[model samples]
Target: MFQNSSFFQNFSTLGKEDTPKSQWIVEDTIANWWRPNFDPPRTLGKEDTPKSQWIVEDTIANWWRPNFDPPRYPYIPAHVTKPKEQTKLFLVQLPDKAYFAVPKNFKLVAAPLFELFDNSNGYGPLIASLPQNLSRFNFLYNPP
Candidate 1:
């Protein structure tokens, strides 16, 4: 199936350019805040621990703590966080392929199809339950 397909080659090459810079940015940010060298050396006394260590911890704790005020946005709620809602999904299988659909209020969390169906041989009643256009379905996982 492999060919000298420039389309595939070019498509793959498109993402390579930003990969190294993105990796470096992530590495630098992590290194700046949590570098191993910034850690207290085994030989060093308690007082010898880098001030950076405390600063990083304080930053993290402040971020997580509700009362810890974030910089200038005083009026904004400090404890504001998104609440996750339970999701329900349906799995519809055709003779050749499978479809995973989520209801309007729910989100789709992609996972292996084999987890729900017996893929050992083939889709059995699962295929028959699906409509001809592959729309009718049943719940894959029920949320509590």
Candidate 2:
């Protein structure tokens, strides 16, 4: 519940004949968050760019915005600007070698730490490895 002051009373007049909506409009607004009525500035070619780089318009992904159909949800989020964008790229290079191998003691060291398991039916114990049997290795060896 809101306080019964002038602040809450003004909200009742919003979009009504009593209040003017022009006061809410901001100059040169770009909606990068999520909205249907909003037309944000197009940059970097969203249609041509890879999905991994940016979020593209999709059915389930754009569920809150609702495209050529009625809105499935009743509520929507508010859009806000941060004045600046931040992008960070990480690239790791591996040493030049013929083949990669896991240490003999890796299983013993990783057993007590963590394990991957599938719990589709119910909760179970830790598994040795996943179906794909994938593992990550950090090569930080220095040779003299």
Clashes of each: 0, 0
Local error of candidate 2 at 123, Å? Answer: 20
* Per-residue lDDT over 51-90 for candidate 2, one digit per residue giving the tens place of the 0 to 100 score: 1122222111111222323222222334512212111111
TM-score of model 1 (CA atoms): 0.14
* Candidate 1 residue lDDT tens string, 1-144: 011243332111001112111334433454453334223334445665333322111111001112333222212244645312211112212223223222233333332444324332232222222232123333465455
lDDT of 2 at 79: 53
**Best-fitting candidate, scored by TM-score:** 1
Residue 107 alpha-carbon offset, candidate 1, angstroms: 38
lDDT of each: 0.27, 0.23
